[model samples]
Target: MTRIKKDFSLPAVFAGFITFLIGISVSSVLVIQAGQVLGANQAQISSWFWALGLSIGLSGLILSWKFKYPVATSWSTAGLALIIATGSGYNLNEAIGAFLICGIMTAVLGFFGIFQRILEFLPQSLTSAMLAGVLLKFGITLFTVMQDQLIYVLVLISTYFVSKKTLPRHSIVITLLACILLTPLFFEYTATKIHYGMTYPVWIQPEFHWSSILGLAIPLLIINMASQYLPGLAMIRSYGYKPHVNQLVSWTGIAQAIFAPFGAFSTNIAAISAAVSLDEQVHQDPAKRYIAGISCGVFYIFMGIFAATLTGLLLSFPREMITTLAAIALFATIGHNISIAFKEDLDRDAALITFLMSASGVQFLGIGSAFWGLVIGFIIYHLMRIQIKKPI
Candidate 1:
């Protein structure tokens, strides 16, 4: 205990907070888009912030504290896609109903231990291609920094390199410090002036519909589990920690169910981007990463309370800043995923199909690029298998 405590300190937790901010910033637009779908008026939009902030905070704290790993939580990107895709067709209540159904399905999947099998069915090649597709755009965006915000971008980039070289553990700290110091100097603060205030969760009642249950619920469950949950489990393992997937998934599902009325959308385990926290807090014993979770939770609750102001603050940042930072942060993973996407000779055809389809950003019946990316990968993979077995 003493050794672990000695390794982790308040400073480390603060570093995690910086990464947490960037992580939320990573996909928050999806959240905002979903909120708009639900007829999220000012207060309700603020409640969207409240729900996500509070959920992330509580979930991050409990899991990170309990497992001694930083278990990041985020609004379900898949769920957001579902709501946006079908939102106009369905009211908020029906969407919530779909969300609730998805949550229950996810919880049941975790409970029955079927999530392990689902990924196996997904084909590793397809999943890799889909992942590569999802992250490729952001990877390009990293270099897109030079187009705008060049000075601060260069400063942050230099800070990032220097911190890695000199401060090692403090690399992200230095990067964040650079962003804060440079924001006012080079960027227009007026662009980012958002209202900061307290917010309480606003509940939206769920109304069940067959269309929502099948169209939104089932697909949402698949995407959330395949893309979000499975990746989250791998994230923990990548950091050399044994993750309790069932416990994490089940708890996240149960919590999501509990919060649906307030437009919580979906809450689930995080990955890829969540890795930033793990890396930033590397020297700290893995178990102590909970402290970072705790800190993140604290910030989450704080933000939820001030959802309006914070939302404004988040909205205030130049769109390019958000896009570039997110894109740059993803550069490393995109390269790695692309390499893996093309790695297997057996899986090559499928992976390429998935990668191309996903990057194409084509919406087939509005299903989104990620879903089709996997679909194309699998189609190619199995089709090749069929071709090889046919009379030759």
Candidate 2:
């Protein structure tokens, strides 16, 4: 207890808080879209936020404490995207059942160390390329939003650069502050009346169908693993953190299973927000960075407790602003991954192929582009190697 208390700092707490804000801001829209597609009503949507927040909070707290690392957790954005795209046929109850099955499969993979082995087989360049591809859309969205909201975007960008140069550690926070202050001036502010109390999680009795399992469950599991979890692990590796891969996988899978019935689709290691918490600016002492994760867990609990109002407030933000924030927060990560993706001579072409395929967002069958990108990239890489060795 004393040691834990000693490790705590305001910088760590602020990092965690900012990370949660950025994480929720970036993907809450997608989560809501997915929930709506699954035929969730307003109350169910609130419950979805509640369940996700609680699960991520608890999992991040326990994992960080046990592992003594900033083990940030989040919902799988790609899984949500898949749900939104392919879940039109399935009702909410069926979707919940599929979520349960997906969680179980994920846990099985973790327990058997399958995910870790898969990561071992994957080269760094390929993973980096996939990550870059996944994040490329956000970079594009940032600039596109800038075109319409040029002045606001310019102010935010200027604040970010100035803060980055001066405050360094609080660059994101400073930019966020600028947004909060500038938003009401350009856009009308509507106060959302949130019920100031603990929100209970709503339970939905799951109805499992074989078709749902094959269609929603399997595809969701694959995308979450390939697009979210795989890149998430790669992000941790990129930051030079040696996380317990199997442990994170198993714990997140367990979390998903526990929360699925309440509309939490999938929980996994966070890629972007984890980067924020794992940064040296969060804490100079790497060993004490777990404080940031714990702080994030606490903030998540607060968000869960006021899930309805918080979701409403976040949704009220202008779309352009939200996209801009996401882009700025992710810009560093996108740049880092792209650099690493092309660093190796042997893997350069393969990585580029993966990047283009993923960025193209071309989905085949029911699976997302990220999975296909990896498959195609891997195939091309091996084929090129074979051709190189053959006699001319």
Candidate 3:
């Protein structure tokens, strides 16, 4: 469309690519570990990428294009973590069935508008606090790596600040370039080890079992809904985007259900990686930022097609470098969220509780800190309200 052409920018495209890179490089190992734990071979492992890439790409593309918002979708990293944490008790077939069940459950919840209704009651301050907590890990890792790789991180940070002042629109782009270009100087390049090719899908027959349904499927549904979608929607809202929560939930759920046999265990809103495309560096006008999502979709499909090769190439970089770069990219976003969380005097105490709880990384009954943070904040906020309104 003419509007698409007019809105396109190199910065936004880079933001999308960064999103793709971060999504893959950050937790792809978890995908492989989960696959291996479920007794998958190399081919099945590659298919995980294929299925995940296509589902996320298609869903993100459709949502962003239709809604004119940067609605990026991603495979559930938290779900993969859950699978790995659960050990190898279940076989691949059971995992696939569990995946299908989770998808169906999510779709049903969204179709009935239940998911949207629950999110509607969330306070913006609490949501912002949760998002900040979600992002704080990256910031902490960035500095931790700085202690070990001081010169390297200093260069990247200096580049970010200098470029931010001189070329505000392209600061992250420039910083990322510096990160890549300077990598060889600080670390070794392993290009020769990377193999390139298309990733073919491998389908496994699904079998339902109560053990997996209760142990894996139900827990997966909970983790993804709380850990991924909730914070993801909060991230979108933190940046002032009003996403159609039901459509997002239902479509990704449907996509996951259809592609479960092909190794797509879960697909949901890409919270952290999506933040790469939400910053001002992607686009000056919030209205035009949907281009970043479209670009991210294109990159997702590209990576999906060459799932094996591109994933290896992206992962070739050191983890510290990728994590640090991601943290730098999120600095502005994190700062914005923190300010919003404490902006209202009435919300400050509860928001602080949420932020601290989320950052603490505590988990109970397999759910993560982000979910607990929201719960605690909700309780505190309501308690504060009752206290003020009580008859003395």
Best by lDDT: 3
lDDT of each: 0.69, 0.82, 0.89
Error of 3 at 92 (Å): 0.8
Candidate 3 lDDT by residue in tens digits, 1-392 = 89999998989889988887888787888899899998999999999889999988998888888998798888877788899988489999988999999999999988899999999999999999989988899998998998888999999999999999999999989998999898888877576377866789999898899999999999999999998899888888888888888888999999999999998899899988888888888988998899889988888888889988888877778888888889999999899899999999999999999999999988899999999999999999988887555588
Q: How do the predictions measure up, each by TM-score?
A: 0.82, 0.90, 0.97
Looking at model 1, report the run of 10 residues with the lowest lDDT sum.
275-284
Better of 1 and 2 by TM-score: 2
Candidate 2 residue runs with Cα over 4 Å from true position: 26-33, 36-39, 384-392
Model 1, span 1-392: residue lDDT tens: 56447556655566457546765665677787887876777667767778777776787778877787778776666567767877887777888788788778878877877765555476655665676676676666766766766776777778777777887666655666666677777766585555554687878878999998988888787777656776666555545666777778888887777777776778888755565555533454566565665666677767777877766677677666666555545544466566766888888988888888777767665456776677667777888877455576
- The superposed Cα distance between candidate 3 and the true structure at residue 258, in angstroms, equals 1.0
The residue ranges of model 3 lying beyond 4 angstroms of the native Cα positions read 388-392
